[model samples]
Target: MTKIVPKILEDPFGNLTIENVLEDIVLGSSPYQVTNPHPYKPISMPRGCGFHGNQTKILIMMYSGPGNINQRRHVRQTWRELKDPNVRLVFLLGLLEDAQYVLEDESDQYGDIVQEDFCESHGNKSTKMVMGYNWAVTHCPAADVILILDETLHVVSDIVFEYIRDLVTESPTRLFRNDIRPDQHTGNSYVNLISFDVAKQFHILFPYIKPKDENLNDYVRTVANILSIKHIYDPYLDHENPASFFAFTGQNVSKHLLTYPLNINFRRLVGRKVLYNEDIPHQPINENLPPNIHRPTRCKLLRKGAVQDQFLVVVWSDAFDSEQRSTIREAWGYPNITVKIVFVVGFLDNHQNKIDAESTTYGDILQVSAKTNKFHDTLKTVATFTWIAQNCENTKFVLFLDGNINVNTSMTMTLMKELVKSNDRKVFLGQVNNELEPDRNAKSLTYVSENDYPFDRVPPRMLGLNYILSFDLIKTFDISFPFVKYCSAVDIYIGIVASKLMLTLRNDERFDRTSHSSFLRGIP
Candidate 1:
C-alpha cells in the first residue's frame, strides 16, 4: 500500500469530532478500524433485527444524532415500508445529551437503537461504517446485506424494496441513488445499499483512508473494487419522487440536490388514477344506473350540499351476501337522514342479474372489481377509497367497516363527528395497533413470509377491520396503494400505508377490536 501522512479533517458540529480516536492513526497502511479509546463513550447496541435466530437478508443501519428525535421518529415510521421480517432496521446514533438525554427508554421500547459516545459530525461520519461493521460482526453476523441509510430519507418506495430484493439474487457491490452518474459512482451521504461482504471490507478501509463526508463514497468504491463486487447503476429509484426518494421537511436541500435537502410530502393521488380535479358528476344508482362500475373515474361530491361535517360509512362485503346486507341494514345501517352508508363489494360473477336487481332496489351498493381473490382484501379497500376520493369531495370523515362488524351506526357516526371536530385535522380512529408481529404459520391463511412483507412488526395502524378515517386519508390510501407492496392482510396493509404517510393514529376506548360489536357496548 502507498504510505502517506494523515491530514486534519474539520467538522462543522464540533472541534474534537472523532479526532480523539485517531491520535495513533495508521496512515496509508493495512485497513483496520480505529478503535483507540476516548473519554465519555457510552455504547448501547442490539443484536441485529433477529428473531429466534433467523438469518437477516438485509440489515439497515441509519445514521442519526442524539438531537434528531423527530427525524428518528419519522424515519422509523417510514422504515415500516420495508415489510420483510428478514430485513432488520437499526438506528446508529452518537452521544449528545441535550436533545436526547434518555435513549435507554427509547431503545428499550423499540429495541432497535445502537448508541456510541462520539458526537455526530461530518468529520466523524466516516466512523459510521466502522461502528456498523463492528455491530454487524458482533450482533448480526449472519446478515447478508448492510445498507448505510442517511437520516434524511423520508419514504422507502416500492422500487426501493423491489431493488433490494433483487440484491439478494444480484449481490451487487453497491446500490446508490438513481441520480448518481457513471462518472460519479459515489453520492454524498445519500443512502447506499451495500452487500455485507462489501460493508465488511469498507469497515476496515474506512479508518485508514478516513475520508471526509463528501469523499466517503470514493473510498466505498475502492472497497468494492478490492472485493471485486459487481457495480450496477439503477435508474428507477430517485430523490424527488415521494413514491421513492424523499427527504425531511424544511429548506435543507443538497447543493447538488439543493444542498442535500429532502422533500417528504406526497402529492395527493389515488390508486390507478390521479384526475381528482375533473368535476364529472356521478348519478345515484337508480334504474338507469349501470349494474357494475369497474374503477370509475373523477366524480363530484356524493351529496349536493356536501360540507366538511358530513361522514360516509363504507362497508366491505362479499358480492353474494345480499342477506348480510339486509341484516346490516336492519341492525345498524338503517336508512338515516344524515349518515350515508355505501357497500363496496366484488362483482357478482354468474349472479350479475341478481346484483342488478339488488342495485335497482338499493342505490347504496358499489362494485369495485370482479370477485376479489382470497387474502387480497386490500385491493377492495383501495378501490373503496378511490371511489370515495373521486366521488366524495368536501366530505369530513369516513367510517370503513367490515360487513361482519356489528357497530352501532348512530353512536359511531356521532362519535366520529365529535372526534373530527375536536381534532380538526386528519386522524385515524378505532383500535390503534403500533407493533404487531406477522403470523409465521405457513399453513395459515394470513401467513406473512419474510420476503412477502419484510417488516418485523406491522406499523402503527387502526387495527380492527372496522375504523373511521378523515376523507383526506381515504384519498391518500387510494393513491398510496400502488406505491407500497401487495399485502394480503387488509388491516396490516392499511397500517403499513398509514405509517408511510405518518398519519395521526388514535385509539378510542369505545373502538374495541376484540369483540364482534365495537364502541358502545364494550371496553368503555
Candidate 2:
C-alpha cells in the first residue's frame, strides 16, 4: 500500500483536493474497476424511456446500499411512475464484489442504477454522493434540479417537481433549499434539493472524499460555506402532515389503505386506469403503526436475559385472549421450569387496561408496540423476533408457539437438548410443509395477490404453531428479514426468510398438528 501524504498534493486553486488521491486508489486498486455503463440509449435514465441523459430537465437520484432490492422495488412501483420523457429516476449503490451479480440482474431489469467503484462503508457514503453528483454533471448536464434523497423516504414526485419547477422559475440562480418546504429552514441530509449549477460548483470544491466522522449534511454545509452558496428555508417540501408532505421518510409513511373500485376485470385493462387520491385515512386500522413501543418499560420490554435459562418459550398472544392466557399460565407457564416462558402481544384496541393489569399481576406478558392485525402476522413475528434478539442476549434456543395450541414442553425440551448435541447452529425445527400452493381465490381470506407473490409453490417452512430456532438462527433472521419482501402468511413469510438465510428447515414428526379439540376442550 502506498502511503498518502496530504502536504505533497496541492491544487493550483490553493484548495487542497483528494481528486488525484482518490483516482489513484480507486483506479489502481485490485477490487475496484469501473465497469462499462450498461449499453442502452439514455444511459442515465431508467430503461424503456425515450429521454436522453442531456435533455432531462429534472433528475431524482436515491442513494442505497447493496442487497436493498426491496427498497428499490418500492421506489420503482411508487415513485418511478413519475418518470417521463423529461424526468428520470436512478439509484446509487456502492460496489460490492459479492453483490455484483445481483446488481447486474437488477440493472438489466431496471436500467437505472449507478454503481460506484469503492469500498462500501457508512463513512464512505459521501464518496458515493460525490460520485452521483459527478455522474449527473457529466451525463445529465441539462437537468435543472437534482433531488438527492435517501432510499428510506417515500416521495410524491408530482408535488416535488412542481415545487422545484416553480422555485427555479421564480429564482433561477439560487443554490440550495431545504426540501421540508414553506416555513421550515433547518436542513437535513435525509432529503436535499440543489440546482444543477450549485451541484457542479459544490463538486469542484469538495470532489467527494471518504467522510471521516461527520454526516452528509454537515459535509454539504461545509461545502456551502466554502462556495458561499445561499441556502433558503422553504416550506414547499416540508409539510407537517406526512400524507400531504412532498417527500417524507418511510417511518412517517403509514400503510396506505387503498380503496380500489370493485372489479373482477383486473386481468383486463380498458384504456388507462384512473388514479385515485392516496390520503391517510382518518381512522387507521390500529394505532400501533411502526417504531413499535414509543416508551417501553422493563416490565413490558424484556431487558437482559436470565443468566441460568438456556431456552425461551414465547407464546404469541393478543390482548383479548385473557382466558387462554390464564389457562396457559396455569398449565405450561411455570416459574420453576428451567426454560423461560412469556406471552408476546401486539397492542389491541379496548384491551390495553386489561393487558396492562394482567402483565402487572403475572409478569409474563411481553407487550410489543407494533400494530398487529390478522393480515399483518408477519409483522408481529418480526417484532417478536427483534425483541428476543435485543433482550435475550444469553439464550441458546427459542421456541415460538401460538396461544391457541398446547405443547408438550417436556418433550420439546428433550428435542432441543438432542439437537444441541449435534453442535449445529442453522437449525429450524418444527412440523414442515413443503408443498403448499398459493391461494388464488380473490374472495378467500387466505388469498395472496399475484403482485405480492407470483410464485406457484411456497418454499419449505415449518408450521408456526410450535417451531424452535437456535439463537444463531434467530440472529440470522434478525439480520436478513429487512432486506426481503414478505407475504401476509406468517408461515410462508418465515419459510421465505429461512430459505434466504440458508437455514435448514428440519421436520420433526413429534411436532404433531393436534386439533383445537385436543388442546382447548377442557381449559377451564
Candidate 1 lDDT by residue in tens digits, 1-524:
21222333223343432323233232453233443323334467885557333433777788877777777887777677655667778888776667464777788888888877787676656566567677776688677777666777655343354446554554344443323434454455466666765565555445445443456667565545543454543322334322234444452333211111122223322322435453212322212212346333323355554432377777887778888888777665366534566888777678767777777777778886534565446666766776787787766788777787666756676687686556554667787654446788999866777665654445455666777787777877765555555567777767656655544466676777555555534321
Best by TM-score: 1
Off by over 4 Å in 2: 1-289, 293-308, 333-337, 372-375, 443-445, 514-524
For candidate 2, which ten residues in a row score worst on lDDT?
Answer: 256-265
TM-scores across all candidates?
A: 0.45, 0.41
lDDT against true structure, model 1: 0.59
Whole-model Cα lDDT of every candidate shown, in order: 0.59, 0.60
**RMSD in Å for model 1:** 20.3
TM-score of the candidate numbered 2? 0.41
How many residue pairs of model 2 clash at the backbone? 11
